[model samples]
Target: MSNRVVQGRMVTPGTLAELIEGSPVLETEDITDADRPCPECDGDVIEVGYMPSVTEFVTGYKCQDCDWSDDDRE
Candidate 1:
């Protein structure tokens, strides 16, 4: 099966298992470090944890001085 994104919408052409199994896996080193300032308060943003998932594929980051999170960005 094949998947394509047309005009910002993804056209699903396969099963859910196919999509999950075919998805790319990333390591901690492969992800960008959270060192930028937070958008809310100019606080130091740091890597707090990772996204909880069946595969646990992505990193989760937050600010040191504020409650800002990078979860939605992923």
Candidate 2:
């Protein structure tokens, strides 16, 4: 009689060895602040996005009462 291993019915010790090695590590850093008030309507300024190439972060402010935005300045 010959011994044969079934695909789904077999699991070796190395099958889950990578899981016990270590957990993944992640690093995060705060880049900018968007807590400044809007100059036009005294609204809150929020962070829209960032431009890593130019090293510039874009911020936009929206007013609920006056409907003002920083886009109007550009």
Candidate number of the best TM-score = 1
Q: Tell me the number of clashing residue pairs for each predicted model.
A: 0, 0
RMSD (Cα, Å) for all candidates, in order, is 13.3, 22.5
lDDT of 2 by residue, 12-33 (tens): 2222111122222122122223
Across residues 1-74, which tens digit of lDDT does each residue of candidate 1 receive?
A: 23333223443322211222344333322123365788998866544223234576444544546546554333
Residue-level lDDT for 62 in candidate 1: 47
> Ten-residue segment with the worst summed lDDT in candidate 2?
16-25
Best by lDDT: 1
| TM-score on alpha carbons, each prediction | 0.44, 0.28
Residue pairs with colliding backbones in model 2 are none
In terms of TM-score, how similar is model 2 to the real structure? 0.28
